[model samples]
Target: MKLASYADGSRDGHLVVVSRDLTQAHYATGIATRLQQVLDDWGFLAPQLEDLAVQLNHGKLRHAFAFEPEKCVAPLPRAYGWAVVDVEGSVRREAGQFQGPHQPLRAPAACEPALAVITGDLAAASDAAAALDALRLLTLAVDWRLDGDLIATHCAPLAVTPDELGEAWGGGRLQARLVALHNGAKLDPRDVAAVPGDALARLARLRALRAGQLAGVSLGALELPLAPGDSLRLDLKSADGQHSLFGAIDLDLAPPPALP
Candidate 1:
């Protein structure tokens, strides 16, 4: 079931169950008022939320109203931890071939794109599930600063989840894409590189996750620079155009302080 947390004049906001088509919603306050609370007790709350979803779809719930994405924040605004697995070059490495320069590559590789754990509180993560049962799901929109330069900034919305996100990596590669926009102008499209066969299996091998921790797998490898007044928008769509995930974040040298 699709779920979202909306701004309700509170830090955690109000949790709601969104319809499949993204048109309508029903307040899930009866089950949980915050998204993190529901995820913390997913075993017990999922079933209850599922039942409510059925009722809402059948026109049986009261106060069901139109749902807008703009009014919603990241599903989990403040998670315990957010880590990204870089699957972009997994395929090429497995075949004993390097896609970049043939020169002797240095150690501590320049752009190996290893698993990166984001620091700070500016990363916004969103979900894109295939069958809704997948444990490893979600995409990310991160605010970044240029290396060694604190003033230059950029926001990258990368790693959209493909429809195969829930499927096992059975000697097959999943296709994905990332489309980025800067100040309303479209940038070049980045085709997601193939994920190696063993990546997913390794991820599954890890111990079960705790309540508030989140793991993300990014699909595309496009990077662009942004200016102070510029805005960035990213959209990741499934190969069949059925499922899509989106994120938007602004860039600034230093954001203004929050109001008291």
Candidate 2:
């Protein structure tokens, strides 16, 4: 089932269930209000959301609305545990809020295309197999690695269940290529080999652990420099390389706020 969060003048926007074709949506008002809430009660809430997704996809809902990509915030506006491991292998806490794909970004030095993994409760010292089982959703993300430090992140509009990935997901990593476009031009597609198990293990190893905490993991390799007024699109394709797996994360980088 595909899920998106629409901007609603709140830190955690309104939750909506998106259609399979990415054309329509319906507010998940009665089922669950926030993505984090669902994550916190995955066993009970996900199946309900999945049922809604099915109904929306099949045109069974009467109040469904057009899915607006531009009005979304990060699937999880603020993750329970969001962090990135630097080149030196140190887990740096990326505590800032995540921007939605269409959200204007304060022009950064560069953007790195990546596959982000959002997980459910995971036990510490979990192996790859265990870690893989804990993964719940997958989405596209653009990372800003400033001087090797994680500065900011822009997440795609929708987050898909791992089952949506089909064969692309295996061995605790996304075995697929990430396509990146900069300034309306296609850059080299990056073959992703980022193992979430490795990253999560590191996170558990370095700090005291918590159960049922949701963490967004980014493992990107392609970096493209940018300036204000530049635009970017990051996408992942199906294993057959025919269509987009998660919808493209399209961003129009905006300049930073002026001095007061």
Candidate 3:
């Protein structure tokens, strides 16, 4: 199994898992379960994590899972919650084809890890509270390769929802486009709602947001199976509109060098 994991910044940062062997589709679920084990150990929604595995690339035998940050939060009291992450898995194939659809971050040069999240059942308050305790100590958790005799463990925390979302974007090769603004340009709520065309409307909303004239700014991206963290901000008026996007990756939870 040639697993290259990365953060899909699209849907609040979902985890993306890919395999090189087209014949390995049967193992997709198994791989996803193993990843869930990681999340369970780290202290996210244990029961909820069981239901998150999904197939993203059935042809290439690739699978994906996502964790919703908004929904994965703890009930209360124990403010501990999932925030950061670092996933590391083995690369059974060449790096070129691993992230062929997914690109690596500019800074760290390493293979990405797979995505994992909870599905099936809605995470309950009780589960969320339990998860909160786990999320607190996640920063001190250690990563280990699936090695029988020689295990290579890295001292790092498990990847979070947003980080995994970045992986999903790169792994899926999905594109994003601007949608609409909610409350664009608030003229002290005294003036009329500045309603412009989709393009210009966004520009006005952004200005209002910058000038602190609006309560908040709302922008949407087009695509399905959003990973949570997938986002790109473009300076519509800047000299041709320079754009900048932020995402995350998982390189700490790398599988062992040897494969089964």
Candidate 4:
């Protein structure tokens, strides 16, 4: 079952259950008003939302409307923490080119699964899976800069979950394709990499994650330099290409005003 937070003219958008095909949606007002609320009480709310999802799939719910990606915000707008775990052995192998001016940051040799703590606000997406059991979505990691200085490692602003990808978590490989674009012109594509499950296991041991805190494990190393207006997109597909995840974020020099 796919879930999303959509704009309803409110600061924290309304929660909605999206159909498998991404065509229709039903407001989850009966379950929760916002996505963060549901995450806060996932133990109780997930089952209820799952039940609503079943009802929508069976055509039992009324008031359903067409779903729109453009009318959506990051699934969790604001999270307490955002950390990306690097896949072991995959990082150095995937660092295709060193585009940044400074020496490329390397994962410490002692750190089994190197982790980076993202500071400031991070863009969220309903499509990317936060936990091992969470629904999986494609995540795009953008190399962002502010006033000509690299501010964050990556900014994932948008993500989409497709129904074709069954709810299968753990013990499998996830292939990722990293593409960099400047003014719509494609840059040299990076080496494709497969994220193994052991990396996630290492992260679970290292981070004492709270209920809704997001853990973004990098599938591979990012070696692209993005300037203002440039963008990075990551497309992940299952081995069979049956299920896929995608996300993109444009670079902005001056950070957006923080929300009150």
Candidate with top TM-score is 2
Tens-digit lDDT track of model 2 for 1-260? 89989999988999999988889999999998888888888989999999999899899999999988888998887886666664456665666468888766665655655566777877767776766677788787777766777677888888988776678876566677777788989887766556766766677664533433434445545646677788878878865556677777887778666789
Error of 1 at 127 (Å): 22
- After TM-score superposition, the amount by which residue 142's alpha carbon in candidate 4 deviates from its true location, in angstroms, is 4.2
Which ten contiguous residues of candidate 3 have the minimum total lDDT?
Answer: 209-218
Error of model 1, residue 1, in angstroms: 1.1
Task: List the lowest-lDDT window of 10 residues for candidate 1.
Answer: 93-102
Q: Give each model's whole-structure lDDT.
A: 0.45, 0.75, 0.21, 0.46
RMSD of each: 11.2, 2.7, 23.0, 10.1
Q: Which wins on TM-score, candidate 2 or candidate 3?
A: 2
**Per-residue C-alpha lDDT of model 3 across residues 1-260, encoded as one tens digit per residue:** 12222233322222233222212212223323333333434335432332322233344222333422222111111111111122121112111111211221222111112121111111233242232222211111111122222122111112222223232233212122222111222111111011111211222322221110111011121122212233211111111212111121122112234656
Give the clash count for each candidate: 2, 1, 49, 3
* Model 1 misplacement above 4 A: 88-140, 148-175, 193-208, 240-243, 246-260
Worst 10 residues of 2 by lDDT: 208-217
| Deviation of model 1 at 205, angstroms | 7.4
Residue 27 miss distance in model 1 (angstroms): 1.4
After superposition, the stretches of candidate 2 with alpha carbons farther than 4 Å from their true spots are: 86-90, 206-219, 255-260
TM-score of each: 0.61, 0.87, 0.16, 0.59
Residue pairs with backbone atoms closer than 3 Å in model 2 (clashes): 121-212
Angstrom error of the Cα, residue 217, model 3: value is 20
Model 1 scores a C-alpha lDDT of 0.45
